[model samples]
Target: MNRFWPISWQRGGLSLIIAALLVFGTVRLFTNAPEVALILGEPWEDMRQRSSAKIDPAIPGSYWGRVITSDARLRLIDLQYGFVTPRARFFTVSFDDNERVSSIRMSPQIEPLLLDDTLKVVLDLQEQWRKGGWIPIRVNYDPPFADTPEWRAQLRNVNKGGTSYWQAGNKYQVMMVVNRFKDERNPTEERYLIKLQLATPWVSQ
Candidate 1:
């Protein structure tokens, strides 16, 4: 028997070692690489105040004209299918490897309105996008997949809604996700979530 190490002390030391390893492993496992996203319809000042990313003067703060990224021309494909609650006043857009916009998301601060109103808003916004040189490349209704299991189950049990998709472009293409939901209390009433994606342009090295 080794008198230098007691059974109780060994057990205690082993437990501490295990705990440290768990903490270190967890930090290594969950930490993700920091990525950048563009803030559409927001001034550089506002975006700068919100995030640590370097902001460039784009559309004079109304839109992010340019952003400084480590990769320079980074692809923003991940944001296309990603979801974020709309909050605050601006929309964040992500870019692709070719330095083209890939995704756009508005803060959830914007509340959902009636379906009719929502449609009107969509049409109006589309018009603005057109003015920005975006042309419709693709249009569809209802996402091929359900928003979520809960939402899907609700759609089956309560009401069915529309998820209209519109892809437009000129110098760059963009995809829009317009989700509409019917009010449970008043089926006549509705709400919506709108997301946009910039087409990832191919770039040759």
Candidate 2:
């Protein structure tokens, strides 16, 4: 038994070396592990030098721009003027990416001159136009009329007689005009113009 112990030791050492070689080869096949690559950098550099690559121009310009992988579908039309006021009544217009008129909003600036002596002209005009209830009437009153008098006289007349007589010379008929954008390709990038006009009906006292 003691003479056979050296033979057993020599066999065990050879088995250990073979097991180490198998493990190293298996790791070399499966892993892209950086530390292992560093150990074999020279061969990897030679492999990369032999490879060919080209640049693509379709890449986005900025980081934020790059993050958007899909194409843009819609854009807001820039209105040169922000908001319309009574001193500046106008129509608001917007276009889609295809350059079609997507939306149009009429904004009238009811100037003090237009409704100076009237109690309900602006409100009545909007309601009547929207509801299609009544034909608008124009009025021209003589001198000594109050500027925007209270609704007392008009309301009292309605309560008593079931009909009201608004001062003849104090009413003005208003009309609005709006211009929409024309159709074009790539509407968002193209320039557009819109115009708004307000006309008053002639009145006789």
Candidate 3:
């Protein structure tokens, strides 16, 4: 990363013009990277090379995007298919190396939602997916899968109006996770967030 910056600058008037050009070029290069659909089955290494992609060391095999940057905002489920998704802070994606499986993306809700709203939105998506030919099955989680959320992930059962979905299928494995978060300013008050993950089925990958 450091290589992207100029290491030395002579203390002269020429330095200012050179510095300006370098910075402008760098920003243009990043901004020029096109933000497109997270195609499933695309090579992970390929996406990593995109200037707009952001990779967090903590989450391997996953990236937050060229499109969903901190300043970038897009609400995709905006009644496009008769279903609207809960507003999210941002999204992260995952991919595999099959016949180009599905592009997996996870979105965390920006704010706490009433348990009722969570259920309604999740059910709406499930029904839509069902009609689209995706089957629902019990989710069998692995090590980091359970620990993906930074908040308390224990409140994931829909029965008590907690987490919404927890299964996967061919078309998409959508999970609406209800998480408990500690309010920094008000510790006594518990805040809950919805974590949505859309992925291509393992069978497809």
Candidate 4:
């Protein structure tokens, strides 16, 4: 018998070879991935539908049932702002009269982290949004952050009140606010809050 054909043509070695070829072809098909950017550039109407589907306002009770119900005090600030220390960051979820999700506020206490900690988070978020093809649009704030000396000194503007508020959003009506505050414990140190407010079309009375 020849060494190459020692296994014998009558044997099932041919079947194993065919199976290996099929597996390799299937893997190659999946390896050639499609461009996500092209696919995700959907029409505004489609994007709106997708966004609304995330938090169906038509739903009866508060969409954040379990999330807010878990903390008794969390519910106290339904329309107003409430404070809660959950996990590593402070969390606050708000709901409209219809019990729909209105906004979510989160802040990382900077006393424990480096000075540029919040700046890093904001930059990373911006990069991700840009990658997703969303651009931030400047929105007017009632008591804008432009007033603060820190802000004015850096930004060259001022407002009436001491509090500073900066807001921006994309076409999807999603707004993000970056707030700077003096650390409670360490007065000299600063802390920041990145409040992501979902500008749902539903307006509260």
Candidate 5:
């Protein structure tokens, strides 16, 4: 295992399960992956209905629930099994008072063995959105990364990291990044959080 994958960040119990899945490829679990990019302004009820339907009886941790936050209400997804869907691990959807989706976030779990593999998938996914006219906004999250032409030029050498903020035709706000951070509790280990946050006022393409 890479020094990054460890028994930290409350993900310790998963270490063995993830390792086991890696060892016996034939026994792999698979399922339909959720789309990481979200459609802002979607009806909360409709979105909640679709999410609630994805639970698996076989995976006890598989669940979607709602919560109220200081700023907005949210739908949280905790899907524990779906190896076939790559890193489709968890999600959070926040909605406005009108019950329209105000933002959607996808935070996929990445294993050490598949860091590069997963990073490639994420960057490719971002490229697809770029092709659809999702250009980087003027500002972004902190970096050792950029989504500009100069930065994208290094795609061939991308390992598992970047920070990019973007917008599409004045309709949405996006932040896509592969963040690598060390757990203070486990200083020697490194981990990556592959996240995509899409935010907007009520509007749709």
Candidate 6:
């Protein structure tokens, strides 16, 4: 009878181990199973539409304007002028949805001795027509000082100036550089050297 008891105990232990292994295998098979297929073919567009539908119409314009303006502020900067040239020049351009750049103007707050400074502006606008598509716009400028390594090094050390642009499914870019002396007493020396600004636009596609 004692021998019979040991055999029964061993059989029970083996059965328990086999049962545990079966349960573990079943659980892993279910976990590794492929997910259910999506009902919507393109999930992003559906989600976008649903989100837009949920938004309150009255507040959306204001919210969108705030978001766009806040985004624009990150690229904007103040224009500064030094002596010898009592005034500084500012250039601004506007673009519409049709990708047409207009309202290009340059105004000088303080008139400099020489108006030889050149301002180059470029605009690029391209957007994805499909839903959930993103396109990026970019603006770039090259400073007059960058023409030579020595002058470029000097500008990099002393003054920090550049042009400004904006992006809204479109790009408005401007580059302005001034090469003038800061003081009238130092006519033979170069004082204020302005560099063109390069602005880049970012969009998630």
Model 6 RMSD to the real structure?
A: 31.2
For residues 1-100, write the lDDT of model 3, one tens digit per residue. 1101111211121223222222211111113232323333454444444424454322344332222443111122312222234333344443332322
Name the candidate that leads on TM-score.
5
Candidate 2 residue lDDT tens string, 1-205:
1101122322343233222222211111112221100111122233223322111112122111001111111111112211111211222222233322222222222111112212233343334333432233332321211223443333224222111112212222223211122223323432111112111223332
Residues 1-205, candidate 1, lDDT per residue (tens digit)? 1201222332243333223222211111112223343333233345444543444433421322342332111222222332222121223443333333333333121344444444454555455555544444423433323346654453344334433333332234344444453434345655444443343322111
> What TM-score fits each model?
0.37, 0.18, 0.44, 0.38, 0.50, 0.22
Task: Name the runs in model 4 displaced over 4 angstroms.
Answer: 1-88, 93-103, 108-115, 139-171, 201-205
Candidate 6 yields a Cα-based lDDT of: 0.24
- Order the numbered candidates by TM-score, best leading: 5, 3, 4, 1, 6, 2
Model 4 Cα displacement at 65 (Å)? 6.7
Query: What are the per-residue Cα lDDT tens digits for candidate 4 across 1-205?
Result: 1101111221233232222222211111112221111011122233224331122222344333112211111111212221122121233333433543444333322122222554454445445445554444442332323333464343222122122222222212233344444334445655344443333222111
Candidate 5 residue pairs in backbone clash: none
State the number of backbone clashes in model 6.
4
Q: Model 1 shows how many backbone clashes?
A: 20
Taking the tens digit of each residue's C-alpha lDDT, what string does model 5 give over 60-117?
2322223221111122221221111234334445555555555554444433323354
Where does candidate 6 have its weakest 10-residue lDDT segment?
A: 65-74
Q: Candidate 3 has which clashing residue pairs, if any?
A: 40-101, 40-102, 40-103, 41-100, 41-101
* Global fold similarity of model 6 (TM-score): 0.22
Sort order, lDDT high to low: 5, 3, 1, 4, 6, 2
CA deviation > 4 Å runs, candidate 6: 1-101, 107-168, 180-189, 193-205
Query: Taking the candidates one at a time, how many backbone clashes does each contain?
Result: 20, 4, 5, 3, 0, 4
What shift in Å separates residue 20 of candidate 3 from its native position after superposition?
32
Per-prediction RMSD in angstroms?
19.0, 38.3, 15.0, 24.8, 11.6, 31.2
- What does the lDDT read for residue 88 in candidate 6? 20
Which regions of candidate 2 deviate over 4 angstroms? Answer: 1-88, 110-121, 133-205
Give each model's whole-structure lDDT.
0.35, 0.22, 0.36, 0.30, 0.41, 0.24
